[model samples]
Target chain A: MPIGDAPPLVRPIVGRANRPAITSHRGRARWERLAPYLLIAPAVLVIVLFRLWPLLLGVNFSFTGDGDRNGTPVGLDNYTDLWNDPVFRIALRNVGLLVLLLPVAVAIPGLLATFIFLRVPGNRLYRTVYFFPAVLSPVIIGSIFNLLLAYDGPLNELLQTAGLGSVDWLGDPKVAIFTVVGVHIWATFGMALVVFLAGFATLDTTLLDAARSDGASLPQVIWHVIVPGLSRTIQFVFVTTMIGMLTSMFGLLYVMTSGGPGGSTYLPEYYIWIQQGQMNRPALASAASTVLFLVMLVVGLAQIGLLRKAGRED
Target chain B: MRELRVTKWVAAVPMMAIALATIYPLIFTLNVALKTRHEYILDRFSLTESLRWDNLGAAWTSGGISRYFINSLIVVGFAVALLLLFGSMAGFALSHLRFRGSRTLFLACLAALFIPFQVIMVPLARTMADTGLMDTYPGLILAYVAQFLPFTIYLMASYYNGIPAEIVDAARIDGNGPFGVYRRIMVPLGAPALLSVGILDALFCWNDVLIALLMMPSAQHRTLMIGVTSLRGQYSSDIPTFSAGVLIAAVPVLAVYLFFQRQIAEAVTAGSMKG
Candidate 1:
């Protein structure tokens, strides 16, 4: 008879409580069956309790109230408040600006990797020197730039020497966001260069030779051959670079601008931080967090999906 | 070929300029750090005549960077250790073991990787407070682990994918259970991956301001990066000492870069390639 077909009166005989079943071969078999879960339990617990659970809780909490109305479900008041907030508006606008600037960010490293792949003089050394800044914390980078971009700092000194007027890099509202973004690019382009080099390692050099043999100009060879060859890597870089701009600039903003000078440099991340950390408005911050999460999900997943489809076609 | 040679040489000029631009800020900071406050104010552009080390001492002691430095070292140390232990176990199971819910658990991990810390910062803080862990070292360390474990596990799993299954099977036949096989085989085999991933995770924990800022609210609890920012406020007029404080925070990373540049680059590329 099958195990489940046994009568209720005899169920105890087949159940785990049976003495021989607990002590003999089947008990060892049970350990074997559950071993993987046992090994993965700590990781599962940590991730679920801290990362995933909090993410769900944060979304749910956004719908609730803050301060006097705490724990009471306010039903989207916080989100509407976020919508009406001007700093949040500027933050979203800056995100758009970052999206527009993404291509230039992706291209610089691509060209650099191409040069390095062609084995330029000191290419090896250049790779190390270029990559050095990418290892340091953004806080450190921001602090260093705070000095460099000081109104009377060395950058202005260099400009004055070159017969140009001093530009207040971090002080002027119109210039601060771009200046911070430029510093971020300077600080990060190296990692992308390394990724591109990794892509270059898999490139079909014979095709480059073929293009050059056909008297194809350098730009034409790059545009037609290398671009198509490295499409997947390019797509990866595009998505990662955009996400980096969204989430990782908090240190830079916090250290350099603190969302000041008319709040021109307020990215979504900085706004979320200000709302939660300084303003004590956790519900509103949760709303911003939800919005940011959705933004990232839409942008990130869309790219990965779009790129996978393109990759399949190619 | 001759024209190509000419163009490459022309390219070197801009490359050289870019390289200088890349390295100039650090060098400038070093120079400013070495100068006296008077010397820095008098002519910030000029190189220091003498190697002044007092500013470093001042930054370390008075700026409280030394205390913060120790705090960072302890927190990052614990966090990286815990992450490696948990991440490798999960990686080994997901890659090698046949079990129910394994795919879902792996997918759960991958999902966590994309939920950047800012998204859950508010609720995470509440969780910590609810558990009475906020501002504690373990609290901050646990936060770092949760924030980074998904990426660590993904890298480890990918690394383990390269290890053939025959060794694991042989180990099983030799009476090594799942934990035993992982301990003796996978952990040793995954050393290079672990090192690369460990260094990256350590850097993230050390470099992160948002998580550290949110999780550790008290001044004494500040990480080195937060300490660097606080010193920035207190020492704004005193450029040399401030530069010294910045250098104190940055020197460890610079040393790591000098030594493990290849590993760091490889780890980053590894993630990108898999993507």
Candidate 2:
């Protein structure tokens, strides 16, 4: 039978029918059939109990004040307060900076991968060295950078020696967000580069060779041939990196600046954490979380829409 | 040949520049870690004559990094184990079994992939506190497993798709149970994916700070990252000591990456593409 013509429901039963007479020995077959689910049960239970339960509880907490003010029901008052809160506005601006930097994160890795795939020598060594930071803990990266960028640290010392005067890196309100962004780009670019490299590997090499022989320049080949081919990888990296930028900014921000220099570095994730952990305003945290979730949902849907459009064009 | 060499050189310069830019800060940090407090103030980047083993020793002993290192290992070990076992099994079922709700479950798994952990951090922390699992190893492990399982399962399932169904059929004909077939056939066949997942998951769990920060708040329960953070305070100028603590925290992870550099690159490449 043709592969696509076969009924999907019949295939598994036929496969199961070939199993041994362990079933004829009474309880063995039933247990055998249920074994896979049994094996996977712990994972399912963990996700449900830990992930799903908390998600539901967060929604519930966003509506009520269960964990705030003696477990009282505050309805949507928390969200009302959040809507007018200036810190939330600052948090939104910080998130906007992150979103604006997304293209840089995607483009740098994409270009690097393209070059590596074009027979760049020592590419393996380059890849390894570049990806090294991705393996380090964000906390470690933040701490190291904090030390290096402090007013009395080496970066400013070098600047002073060069007669440019010292620039505040982590302490200045104007530059703290950029410092965090620079560190983030360094820590995350490697994996995105690797992913792009992988995507490039799947491209048809013959087409590249053909393009080259036809007098296509490297830039032309990349712009025409490689870019189109690696669109899926680009989309995947874009979405995941955007999600990381949205969520994982907390560690670096917390360790490096702690939203300091008058809260200029405060992202929504950091703002929510402070509200919940330090301020003991669980309801406001929930409200902020709800807003963050909505923002993520909107971005996610837009990404999906864009990907689908790209898929259709391809 | 000259043109080709020129092209290669041009391509390499940018890569090298980017690599150097990325690596310079780390090299600077290493230099700072070796300096004494006096040297730190005098010349943060310059090499110091007072490079003391005592600094790292003190960080290890006094900074409480040794305990945190052990704690990280235990948590990563258990979490990776659970991910491998349960993740691969779910992968097998989704690929081979034609049970009711299998498709729905698979889609659920996919949806879980997009949900960022920050969205659930507050509620998850509350749940942990309620369950009396705060500041404990098992609590952190359980949370890590939940966070990582979706991606792991998706990866293993895609890898399993590449296996020939005839092997599974042949095993079934030989009277192997579903568990037996999985154990004998699928496990060995899926070894590459499992190894890849194990390495990635282990690295993630080892390097994780946020969950460890929120879930394990006690000083005794803090991970290496937390230990390093605690070294920094308002009035203290313990740069060398803090840098030492940072170095101590990073050594294992950097060492592991260097040792398994090729496997990790390949695994990351494979996971991103397939996943």
Candidate 3:
């Protein structure tokens, strides 16, 4: 038997064997009392200094101005500037577009996981292949897609060969955001797929078995049985997919669009980057950052509330 | 589930197509990377007549990817090391040791996890600048640790929670103190969790662009992802070399994915379930 499972009486014998290791009871006790704090200090220190403290500082910094009014508080002037900027407005509109597309983003992975769960042909291979891209950096994905989506790129070449007029994918403002979002989904749905598969692992297979025995159609089984059973995972996916779209598409936008063709592809994260890094407006960037945080906060909490209500109805 | 025999096969058709689409971009890049510029212009989609390695050589040698690759290596390597050490230490403490403010500390970590980098980048840049750590290797490393430490601690704590408390008790009764137990017992026992969390943290640090961009602003300090971004502008007319640079940047991650796919999946799902 393991020492962990041994009787209490045996601990005394073990203690006696190593008695020299703890020479002083008071010293040992003091060390024991301080050990946890010592261990946690580095992590706590880094987080508080770099992560938590910066959040408070960023919000405070947002109220100040840039350049001539650097340290002087402008009292929400930066926010009004953000509100007035057309590019920021486009960024906000693109955010709304992402929210609209969130369902399609979640559904692609959910349905794929369902099929994989149902033991479709090449399920294992599909799972492995699909998840591969999720591990890749968005910069790589965007670069590759940049080649494929170029006007004289292979995609356009294929379209022309098929006798269809080729579209200017990244060069057109109307199509640039959608193209980036589509590539974002393509790159990240695998992540949600893996998450969905994990949810499938937790699912009560008996429900699936019962549905099959009852001769339920595929769509019916998906709607009634699978959806209800995996509601939590669905909700998780929805919130995460939304968050991923909002925050993680920076590399793609930077590489593929650079918020280009009149800044049509500007997400808030990219907006924050450009203002701070390119435009040298740290205060304005902070305001955009604060607004982005609020947007995420509202969206995340609203998602949880809405999903809980929907789950309850189910 | 197997009862949908016809449906499964029919579904497989589209599934295979999707799989092809998923894998095709990388394959196309690889093919293009192996092609001469002349060959690429003539036929972008065709298989390379020869396994030409010149573009790869040129990219690795002259495209600045090599420097960025080393920069990423040093930064990610140190960041992952520190993350695992601090993460496991804090994990063991929070999960096993009775202490003041333990609960609050854990909650603080959890709260930090939700604050995305964009939300924190501005002040963080300022903080780094104020401390004279901006545009340096250590600044970026510290930034990555801050960005990922919470998730690391959470996962490590969750994993450590599963190990029987009786084991810790046994170690203590055997006259080993907290540090002794940690070094002799917890680290070894926590190796699996460390590996999973370490790989995940490494990937996050490695694939990161925005943080690296903000923290390391110099031309020579670019991480690989940042390097890949510049490859586009540098080689705008040279698609083969651009693809070659991208392939170079991807190879490390692709190798890691191929080897640790299961652990990566486990770490990812563990995160999702807990969150």
Candidate 4:
């Protein structure tokens, strides 16, 4: 009986000592399993810290009286002030104008892509050429177009040689926005063309062939078959183009006009940058950013809603 | 036969015009870059009488393009590497692992796809300042990695999903661990996605200006795009030099695009159609 009791006590102590070793083994396995997450944690943390956190802070700052870098908290005055400000109003109008003119820019690439998709001779050449502008930086595109559209630039010179009146492309407020839009279209259409070409390739050739055999004209085939197949691509391009128009248009406005000649070409993005970078109005910039965010969110949601409706109907 | 011929001709006309319009700007820029100041001013649209290699040399040397080129390479290189390593690992985990909160993590990443850079520019800049990361190469790379990782992860994850799972299970049966599976099986199989993502991310980083402008404000670390922008103000009168800088800034990206056009074309088609 004494030996039995001693053996039981010794076994329990030995088991306790070995318990740590077993726990460590489990820990090692767990760590191995979690290593991939650890690898990705840096990326997730960076995005959350830099991108999402800043967005949250920006929203918070927009509401307070934090007009500059150092300030005490105030209430919703920034929003009210923007409502009363004419420059902001003009910026809003400019954005509206951008939306109106965006379709023309968007349509050009789609049509170009469709033509390329037909595999007409020189399709590769067309693709290479069409994609050239996209490879050029926006600043370059802006500068090139600036020289072309300047009062004494080649565009006006060509017009004069052709006996057409030489109009000031960047000077006239009425047409300044149009010139910016035109350049914006030219600068970006390559990426759009590439995307559309991609969309075109996925189109069911069999459906097209069948449609053609049934005596569907080219226009009808495009209208009935190709267009339907490309509906998803159209949605992607539309949303991205809208977002680009809203955000990336700043590069063009910056290099070309600097929102000059009475701020007729002033975009909201340029407006925000000026407030933050130049004027030291961090609060106002925050407010503008918040507004920009809300606008994008609403527009993006509307686009999704429309696409879903269309998807369901089809 | 007659109708088919007419159809072909009709299609060719628009395609040709679109192609010319696109190609003309690039050609015209090149032509302007080669011309003397006198020639540029005399006839802005005309081709140069003589090729000027000196303009390119001047732009490369005196225009501080050498520094800018190196800076761009550092930023783009680091950003692409980080993006690939982190993005592919995350993609593999999300697609392969059956852990809790995996779906939620994936959704969080997907939501990030919609947030534009404009929305976060000010706060992000402020954060960089607060952390003393401003005006550093690492700071710029970190920002770019954060900005681009979402789309990269999404693309990689989708591509990984398309990959057959049997190979992973087979690897597991063959005594390969998860990391081994990822390294030995998934990555090699996912090479196409990795290549396309690498090219696209490189292009994006090379062309980007806003982050470079805000983060690396010094001329010493300025990117080529920023360098070209600065040339405009400095060489306001010398249109040819400015044009030359623009041409120099465009060459690397154009070269890459031309070289990988086939892969890029396929990737873009795949992403757009499937997504």
What are the per-model numbers of colliding residue pairs? 0, 1, 0, 1
lDDT of each: 0.89, 0.80, 0.90, 0.80
Clashing pairs in 3: none
Off by over 4 Å in 4: A1-28, A67-71, A307-314, B1-5
A-chain TM-score of every model: 0.90, 0.88, 0.93, 0.89
Listed in order, the DockQ scores are: 0.54, 0.55, 0.56, 0.42
State the C-alpha RMSD over the true interface residues for candidate 3, after superposing those residues: 5.4
lDDT of 4 by residue, B1-275 (tens): 34554787788887788777777777888898898889887878767997887787888888888888898998999999999988898888777655556677788888787777877888888888999999999999998998899888888988898877777777766656567778998789999899998888888788887778878988798988888888888778888877888888888878998899876666555557666
The fraction of reference interface contacts (C-alpha pairs within 8 A across chains A and B) present in each candidate is 0.70, 0.59, 0.73, 0.47
**TM-score of each predicted structure versus truth:** 0.95, 0.92, 0.96, 0.92
**Candidate 1 CAPRI level:** medium
lDDT tens digits, residue span B3-60, model 2: 5457887889888888898888778777777878887777665677776667788778
Deviating ranges (above 4 Å) for candidate 3: A1-23, B1-3
Residue by residue across A201-303, what tens digits does model 1's lDDT show? Answer: 9999899998888888778878889988998899989888988999999999999999979989999999988888889999999999999989987888877
Clashing residue pairs, candidate 2?
Answer: A20-B175
Report the poorest 10 consecutive residues by lDDT, candidate 1 chain B: B1-10
Pitting candidate 1 against candidate 2, the one with the higher lDDT is: 1
Please give the range of 10 consecutive residues that has the lowest summed lDDT in model 4 chain A: A1-10
